[model samples]
Target: MSEENTPTSKSTDINERHRVRMERKKEIVDDKIQQAQRKAGVIVITTGNGKGKSSSGFGMVIRAMGNDMKVGVVQFIKGAMSTGEEKFLHRFPDEVSIHAMGEGYTWNTQNRERDMEKAEAAWAKSKEYLSDPSIGLVLLDELNIALKYHYLDVHKVIADLQARPPMQHVVITGRGALPELIAVADTVTEMQEVKHAFKSGIGAQAGVEW
Candidate 1:
């Protein structure tokens, strides 16, 4: 074969091009990182039809705890059943405060008035955490579901969230997050349902789905 068209030469050329591309990408990423000098806390929203929204929020709770920060969690529509995150985070009484206030899902409860009452109670607890500067991060788990059902007023929630401590972060998780919440959030992640194991024959497993 000719030297110009050799397989080894082509491989080397491709590798060199990849290296150059990655180097440029690294520089751009590094520049962005350096340019981000703001130290204020952020609002993060995890929503959509897929699962893992509350899981992601709890992961941040653990992350914040790892940094020696206090966290408060209010589970809006999950008090009927215990969860792994709740069980685990409850172990840290000083670092974490968890309130699972909901009676259950709306369908199971079948009472709008009761659901609204529970939601209001949960919101009151969440607001306490939001106002506390000592609480570094607040997780409003499954709050979007309550908002979607109109158990709580979206505008009031948004206004209270806006008034939270400047350096206290917040995470709201559930399917169908409101556009108003998304607009004000610094980070918004939507977990789209591509496929689910439960749709097959598998049931909700321990540690994974709980």
Candidate 2:
């Protein structure tokens, strides 16, 4: 075979082409990173039919805590049962403030008045965190569910969220995030459910669900 068609030569050519491609990709990525220079806290909404809304929100809380930032969390429609995140976060009382105010999910509670009262109470607690400049991240876990059910006024919620300290981040997690909330959110993530273990006759296991 000719030298140009030899295996070593072909390999070198392939590597050269790949290197050029990656270099071009790197430039585009770097430019985008350069454009993202503003350093302000943001409103992040994680909503969908899939799992991980609360899980993802808690992940941010953990990330913030790792950076030595104080975190405050309020869970709506999920206080009826003990969750892994709640148990773990409770250990660090000084760095984290977590409150589970809901008695249970709406369908299980079946009491609109009680659910509404719980939601209002939870929002009141969340506002305390939002107003505090010391709290770097505030996680309003499952707040979207309450907003969807109209347990709390969406406008009032937005106003409180908007009025938070300019450098404090907020995360709202649940399904059916309202359009108004989405409109004001700095980042909106909608998890798409493809396959679920629950659909395959698997019960919720600790550390995976709840």
Candidate 3:
């Protein structure tokens, strides 16, 4: 067999090329990381028409708790149904304070006034948490939806978020995040749903959709 076609030779060459490429990539990544010297609390917004928005926020809450950081969670537009995250996080009462404040989706509640009231109440609680420097991470889950529906004032929310403690991270998750909020966010992620099991007639199941 030709030397170039030999299996061992080809494998060795490929491995060497991959190693060189990875080394170069690592150097570039390290330089970028080193250049990022400024450290402070970040505002992360997860919004779009897809799954895992709130799940991502909860995951961060768990991470913060694991690091012994105090976290506060205010869930908007999800009180009608009990979720696995709520149940699980509620167990850590000392580390995490969770509030699920929503009568349900707009369709289910069919009362804009009541929805506004709940959203306002939830925001009131969230403001308290935001002002608390002891809380390292504050997750305003589904607050975007409340803003989208005009239940809460986006300007006021932005002002409060901007005025939060310098080292307190905040995460807001929901669909249809406003442009003004996105503009002020430090990190913004938009989830896109290519295909969902619900479309295939598969209902939400425990430990997954909840």
The C-alpha TM-scores of every prediction are 0.94, 0.96, 0.98
Where in model 2 is the C-alpha error above 4 Å?
Answer: none
Each prediction's Cα RMSD?
1.4, 1.2, 0.8
* TM-score preference between candidates 1 and 3, better one: 3
Ranking by TM-score: 3, 2, 1
lDDT of 3 by residue, 1-210 (tens): 899999999999999999999999999999999999899999999999989899999899989988999999998988778889888888889999878885777789889999999999999999999999999999999999899999999999999998999999999999999999999999999999999999999998999998
Q: How big is the positional error of residue 27 in model 2, measured in Å on the Cα after superposition? A: 0.8
Candidate 1 structure quality by residue, lDDT tens digits, 89-135:
87899999989975878889999999999999999999999999999
**lDDT, candidate 2, 85-173, per-residue tens:** 99999999999998898487889989999899989989889989999999999999999999999999999999999899999999999
Judging by TM-score against the true structure, name the best candidate.
3
Residue ranges of candidate 3 with Cα displaced over 4 Å: none
Clashing pairs in 3: none
Score residue 120 of candidate 2 by CA lDDT.
90
